[model samples]
Target chain A: MLLQASNLTIGYGNHIVQHHLNLVAEVGDLICLTGLNGSGKSTLLRTLAGLQKSLGGHITFRGKDVGKLTNEERAKLFALVLTDNIAVENLTIHDLVAMGRLPYTGWSGNLSANDEKIVKESLAQVNLLHKSESLICEVSDGEKQRGVIAKALAQDTPLVLLDEPTAHLDLPNRIEIMLLLRRLSVHTRKTFILSTHELDLALQMADKIWLMGNDGVQVGVPEDLMLTGKFQETFGSTAFRFDETDGHCKINHLLGTLTVAVTGESPATLWLERALFRCGISVVPNADIVIEAHQGCFRLQNQEVHSIEEVLHHLLC
Target chain B: MNRTYKNGLLFTGLLIVATIVFACDIVFGNVRLPLSALWSDDVLYREIIYNFRLPKALTAVVTGAAISVAGLIMQTLFRNPLAGPYVLGVSSGASLGVAVYLLAGSLLPIAFVQSGWGLVISAVIGAVLVLLMVLGISFRVRQAVSLLIVGIMFGQIAGSLVTILQNNSNPDSLKLFVVWTFGSLSAVSWTYMQVLVPLVVLGLFLTFFIQKSLNGLLLGENYARGLGINIGRTRLLIIISVALLAGTTTAFTGPIAFIGMAVPHLVRGLFRTSDHRITIPGSILCGATLLLLCDLATQLPADGYTLPINAISALVGAPIIIWIILKNK
Candidate 1:
């Protein structure tokens, strides 16, 4: 096990977030902790990363007390990428990433050649080599996020923890970052535990999902979660429906499957299925609305609709 | 360690140069003496050099080095570009002491015979009192903003009282207050230097031990703790260094202006780095050199009556600040 929190009771200044939370993540495992805002998702990540003090219980990493190690030693074991934007102004990407090598450096903060090599490699791994000379403040949001990840990779630690790494990203950027993290975990054999609101994306990619909902905390693979009905319970909410089959979240289907209307000029093959569905009809593989007017739509697979003349003929006959 | 060692070596070189400058400034003043006559201990040259010039030069060198180091520690501890000896109003409180002793005549019984000694003692007391107030406030408020406002308020309160005392002083003592306000380096006797130099050296050595801790502090107090720095003690230690340096310099030199605030700012710009390993020692050298230049320029006896040292510093200091603004823009 790379890290395990033993019944850790965590809180700040009289308010407690969670209690009796126990979980173990192994090497090369990508885990996601998902919950609503203020549901202790970030708190659990902070507790495991040793950034926040555990009020009652303790966290152990590799059978050693996380609290017992010296600060620099713990830094060698785990690196965290918090939600805050990097504070340092005007430092280049290379300079920003090199701070991860500070623990290995001497007290004077000078870097060795090996440390320099690691920093360069980490920057390249983040696909940021071309941007290494640019200032952090000059980069876009996605680039800045990658720069932070590069900083963590520069640490060369076995365990990396991030809080909401994909919170502010758009769709393509979000998938790209999650995939990058997945690739990093596989390539380096390091464990990554990131708290993300992107449950469907995480469910598809992660080795295990540490679900933190109204209940304390649970650890299991996405398939195990489905069999145990934990996946539905964990992400089940008032406004959204979790489609476990396709591993996606969609707006809740109200009266009938919330049908989409197709009204474009061509696309006739797909258009008939869409018109049927728009008028409060469901799409079935071999049962409802037989196919006609097949030129308008191309991608709508197995649904059919009636022509205006057929409706009139049925009424007259 | 090698870099710190090299920095120490550089410090020794600057100390030597400062000592030579001190001797030259003292031995060559307004009155030019025949070499043979001066060497034979001529009455006029001998009195001027021994009684007046030597004390004055020593004060400038020592105060420059001490306050510059203080500014370095202040900037590091607060992680602020503008932190300085006077920004905390540590010197204003000392001025209050000078006001009480010279203008108010409140310590006549204690000073007894030496009129000047009363002012120095009271000034030291006043500065230390303000130091305690700052230290006490720092514990409750960690943000630089609150501490800065608290310091400014302390200075304003002290300044108002000093003005009141100044309005009531007699002519002879009023001259003393006026001279002190303009700031002269000739107030410290050799006896005072014996008391001050060792303390400054000790404080500076202590600073070297915590150089890494100070660097960690640059990240913020929480980050420093995450790096295992004992935050409370480190903060107390910084306060002690600033207080000792500021208190001692203001005690004898009467709050030498511009050097404390401007020297650290100028040094950082010159070095193009913020790492204290270079910044602290660099400030010392730059500060001492600038003050020596200012002190020399103050000797415009070419006009038959020289300008005050503080006036000369303000003249030089203002242009540099304007240049800094222009260059940054």
Candidate 2:
């Protein structure tokens, strides 16, 4: 194991957010830490990353107590990417990434040729080598986050920890970041512990998931946790329900007992069902009210509606 | 414009400018010693050129470099654009320290806050006291903006204290204190230079050692800690270095203004890089050159008397600060 946490309690001051947490992170494992806001995801990450002292219990890296390691030693073992927006001006991606070599570069921090190569390799890993010369202020938010990850990779630690790496990113960019992290974990065999709100993506990509809540912490593979109904127990709410199979949230509005039969499986049919479900109505295989949804149009009860809005209006009125 | 090329050009350009300004500051005064004056045999001219102007010029250079570097560190440490040695109350604290010593010399032994070394000691004590207070508050208040407010409050409180001392002071002591507050480059004779030069050089040398850590700090405290930077130790080191630079300069030259507050922004604008490796040295050079130029502007009227150095610095510095705010906007 690259890292192990046993019987751990994590929190700030006297407030305990989680306790009795036991987990092991092996090399190449991409573990996603998922929890509601204030549920100790950040606190746990901070404790494990050695940014804060653990409230209780033992955390070891390669059989060495984390608390025993010097800061330089811990630095060689773990790299971190934080969610803080960097307000630096005129700092280039190259300089920012090169800073990761601090522990290795001695007091002067003058990067040697080997360190330079590592920086380039890290930036290349994040596909940001082209922008290495560009000032940090010139980059988009996603690119800047990637540049920060590149900095972590340049640290050359055995483990990487990130907090909300996907926050404030567009869908494609969020997927891109996760895929990049997962690929890096596999290719480099580095242990990764990331706390993020990208649940569906985390479920699809993570090797293991650390679920935290008021009830406590649950550690298991995504599928195992899903099968055990832990996801539903942790995330289900009056306004939303967790879909275990797809690992996504669905609106929990109560639908009327009456059902409508939708004719086909297509974009139009999907929209028709979505519209019907949104109006507290469900579509089934058999019902008195039948809708034929085809290319760009919907035929509801023998009347054609040009748009979903019109179809909803006729169906409800 | 490639970043490396731009940094290189700015560095080389600033070096040339600093050297020229250094020479200009030494040569241009009531007695305009030409570049050839160094070779002349007139002893009086040599005395005026070497003993008088040389020390004054060097003091200006050292003062400019020291305070601006301290300002850059404060700006980075607090993650605030407006944060500087002056705004954070380190200078005001130094001012209050000197004011107390000058006004109450009968009460507190004269040997304690005497002249050259005495002022440096008192100023450092004052600056460090304020620094400790700021650091104490900073530990509890995580927000850089809030910490900035605390610094401004410190400045206000220090200013009020200095005003109280001024009111009670005798006219002779009061005039001296008021003149000191106006600030001076000419006041640093060769005797004071012996102390001022080494402290400023040492403070700047220490900066190179912490350059990487300062870069880590630019990412904010938690992230810096994650990178294995001991934030508490680093913060203390920065405060001490700033104190040495700012307090010593304030002691030797009195409360010279604006270089500490404005030069870092001007350097960032000129070089367009936040990397402290570049910014620290860059601010040092630009600060020295700008202060020298401002000193030259002070002597431009050639009235045998001089304009207050603080007024010239503020005239130059205040506009740059406004430009930065507008640019950021």
Candidate 3:
């Protein structure tokens, strides 16, 4: 095991946000922690990374209690990428990443040849070697995040903990970062435990999922958790239903026992049914109201509507 | 250009310029002495050279270096570009100390406030008091922006107290106090230099020890801890160093302005790096040179009168602060 938290309690001051929680992270495992707003995900990550004191219980990394280790020793075992904004100015990417070697370097933080090699390798791993000389302020947000991840990688720790690593990124960038993290775990065997709101991506890529909610914490693989109905139980809402097979959240609409036949083999017909479902209507062959959606037009109840908007207006009227 | 090569060239260039400035400051003052006067048979010229100009120039160098380094630490600790000893009320605290001694001590014997040790002690105590209060508030409020506001409030409080003292002071004492507040390097006699030199040197040495930790802090307190820095200890050390530098310099030469706040920015622009390992030393050298130049500028050679050193620093410093604000935006 890379890290294990047994019966852990975490919170700030006197308030306990999470209690009696147990989690075990194996080597090379990509664990994604998902929770609602203010659900102790960040607090738990901070505690496990040894950046904060746990109120009770023990966190052991490599079979040793975390509280007993000195700060330098803990740093050798864990590296963290937080959501804190980087405020430094005129700092190059190489210089920023070189700071990760503070635990191993001398008091002056002068990087040795081996340390330089490691910095380069980490930058290469993040695919940011080309921008190593660029100032941090000159880089895009996605590139800055990759630089931060590269800094964490340069620490040479066994486990890396990141909070909202894909928070502000677009879809392509978000997917790219997830793939990069997965690849790093597979190729370098470094364990990653990150908290994120990207459920579909988390479900697709994570080796383990830790879900936190009002019912306490649930830990399992994505498929097992979905099969056991724990995912829906933890994150279910009155407005939506969790699609178990497709791993998606869809609007929950009452069909009202009234259905309209949806005709035509094109994608327009499928979208017509979707619009109808959104309005609490369903598709059936024997219903009085029938709609046929061809290329740019909709035929509803013998009335030809040129657009989906017009079709919905005509059917509802 | 390679950053290392650029840093090396800039460091060497600063050293050369500081040396030239030091010599020029000693040579050209209110009384322009010839460079060959030391080797001449004139005993008065020798006395002025050894006892007056040399000490004054050295005082400027030491005070400049200390205050600039203090300002650099303040900028990093608060993560505010405008943070400095003067702007943060540390110097105002020193000024309040001097005000109390000069204005309130009027009821006592003349010898009480005139002693060099008395002034230095009172000023150090005052600066340390304000430093402790600021540190206390910073400990409670983790927000840098709020801490900055608190510092400015402290400055205002100290400034108002000094104003009250000035209003209540006698005319003779008020005139003396006004001149003192204007700042001067020539007032630092040989006796003060003995104390000032070692204190400034020690403060600069302490800066070297914390440079790496200061680099870790560039991101913020949380990230610094992740890199194994004891944030509380670092903060304490920084406060102590700033107090020593600012308090001692203000005590010896009065509250010299702008050198502390502007030199670090100048060094960063010159070196093009935010790493403190370079900036700390860079600020020290750049500070020494800039203040030496300012000292030279204060001497009205043609009119045989000197402008207030405080005025020159503000003239030089205020624009730099404005530029930094605009650049950051």
Top-scoring candidate (DockQ): 3
lDDT of model 1, residue A98: 74
lDDT of 1 by residue, B1-329 (tens): 45457657766776687666665565555654454533666677777776777667767777787888887777666666567777677789899988787777754675342666677788888888887898899899857567778888999988998888878878887888888878777667878878778777776776766666676565555445444456778888888888778787888777777677677777656544455666677777777777777777777576335568778877876677667668766
Residues A1-317 of candidate 3 have per-residue lDDT tens digits of: 87999989999879899999999999999999997878899999999877778999889988999999887788788888999999687889998899888878887878899999999999999999999999999999899999999999999999999999999999999999999999999999999999999999999999999999864799999889888988778877788877877888888887766678888767898788888898877878778877887767888777788877887787677
Residue range B227-277, candidate 2, lDDT tens digits = 778787787778778878887888777777777878989888787777788
Error of 1 at B125 (Å): 2.9
Candidate 2 residue B279 Cα shift, in angstroms, is: 2.4
Question: Whole-model lDDT, candidate 2?
Answer: 0.85
Note the Cα lDDT for every prediction shown: 0.73, 0.85, 0.86
What is candidate 2's lDDT per residue for A1-317, written digit by digit as tens?
Answer: 88999999998889888888898999889999998888889889989988878889999888989999888888889999987888788888998898788888777667899999999999999999999988888899899999999999999999999999999999989999999999998899998899998888988999999998786888899999988888888876788877756767888768988688889559888877888888998878889988887777788777887888997788777
- Pairs with steric clashes in candidate 2: A90-B274
Evaluate model 3: give its lDDT.
0.86
Give lDDT for model 1.
0.73
Relative to the true structure, candidate 1 has a C-alpha RMSD (angstroms) of 6.9
